[model samples]
Target: MRQSQNGGKRVLIVGGAGYLGSILSRKLLSNGFKVKVLDVLMYGREPIEEMLAHDAFELVEGDMRNISTLVKAIERVDQVVNLAAIVGDPACTLKPADTIETNFLANRALAEACKYNQINRFVYASTCSVYGMMEGDEKLTEESSLNPVSLYARSKVQAEEGILSLEDENFSPTILRMSTLYGYSPRMRFDLVVNTMTKNAVIDKKIFVHGGGKQWRPLLNVEDAAEAYMRVLQEPLKNVKGQTFNVGSEEQNYQILDIAKAVKESVPNAKLIVEGEEKDLRNYFVSFSKIEKTLEFKAVKQLKDSIFRIKKAIEDNRFSNINDPKYYNVEIG
Candidate 1:
């Protein structure tokens, strides 16, 4: 039987030092789950540095692609949350080979390891980017056809297919197709849509709306994303196992121009600049009915809240230098 309470359970959060992982790790620890993070720490360890003091938290500094390292990380873990990936399109495009190796191949291997080790509850992080381009104001759902337009999205689709194929009575995996994430994190990233706009508005007093500013995106706060994961982890295995949830609220969806305008509203003096003509092909908004109906999960934070919160963080000089390459995934790649 699976552990009902978080107190004694062990969870291995692969890539636990990344933006979303950083928040999730802290939440799991506070709720009494022992978290063992296996990450290359390619960015740095500062995101999880404070976690080292907690006796329940453990960090295994290594690459997920390394089979030996993966095996070692899952030694006694009860559940696994796989979040390691070459996150953005630009980053994945810059390094296609690394992207496939890390995002798809390594993820399959980890799921296989978990399956064989009797870790039935595996939560995989997918993205709504799988719905590449939707026309006619249609809202894509979990059952919608995937039209991945980039290597990053394609890798996630393939990984989801491969991981779900491993599901059975003894090994059930849940896929959380997360929306574009924003807001502050210990390992801050300015490359995402909302964060980038907010950061540019705060620093340069300008917000750029590329691709004609009409592309639609479903935004989710980092804290809310972590809550979705925790909800799945806490729910009974029968409820979440072998399920794919689009993790975001319906009302949070907005177009590029609107997002830029919101950031401009927060910054007040920032100028909104429109550039190019529909360069980006990704423009699909998603439906969150499935997750809401099943897990009773609804994203609490709104885009305006995220914009103001991030703006305040920037105004307070929370980040030493937002221009640092570490803040942009593509730049790091």
Candidate 2:
């Protein structure tokens, strides 16, 4: 049985120093969990360096691909949240070999390790991009056929299958198919749609929309994404075991043009320019009803709120250099 929201519930958050992971680490620590972050910190250590002072926080700086590292990291862990990956389409394409090793093979090994170590809950972070380029107005559910067009999405699909195959009475794995994340994190990213658009509008004075910006995308606040993981961890094994939940509200889905307009609204003088064919093959809306129905998880942050929040962050210079390679997964990968 799970600890049921008690203190001293130790968690190993793989890639916990990355964008979304950084946000989650802070949350878990605040909630009284002994948070262990196993990350290469590929970007840098500054994102989570402050947490080093917290008694409840521990940072295991190592590669997830290393079995010895996994063995050490999972020690005394009650839950495992796998958030490490190549992250986006371009990053996977840029480093195909690395993507395969990290996203698929390494994840499979991690899930197996969790099972071996008797870790009660293993939550895997997946993407809504797995529902790539669906037809019509259908909001893709967990049961919907996946049409992954990019190597990134393909790796997640393969990894999800691999992780789920290990689920049994001892090991419970819950998959979260997260929407495209926005808003700010301690370890920030401007590569995502809202962040990118808001950054461009503020810094570049212009916003670029590709393929006329008509693709449907579900957006989730980075903070809300963190909350979903917390909720899943608190729930009993029987409720979330071997389950996959889409983690964004249905109303949060929007066309790219709508995203651009929001950025324009936030950044007063920004000009919007549409260009090119939809070079990116990803276009799909997701349904969050399953998570809402099962765990009462509904994303509270709105798209406009994310846009303005990012805009405010930039104006305050909370993050520096919009073109910094650190902000871009593909460039850094």
* RMSD, one per candidate, in order: 1.8, 1.8
lDDT of 1 by residue, 85-165 (tens): 999898899899999999999999999999999998999999999999896777898989999999999999999999999
By lDDT, the best candidate is 1
TM-score of 1: 0.97
**For residues 143-166, what per-residue lDDT tens digits would candidate 2 score against the true structure?**
999999999999999999999999
Q: lDDT (0-100) at residue 82 of candidate 2?
A: 95
118 Cα displacement, candidate 1 (Å): 1.0
What TM-score would every model get versus the actual structure?
Answer: 0.97, 0.96
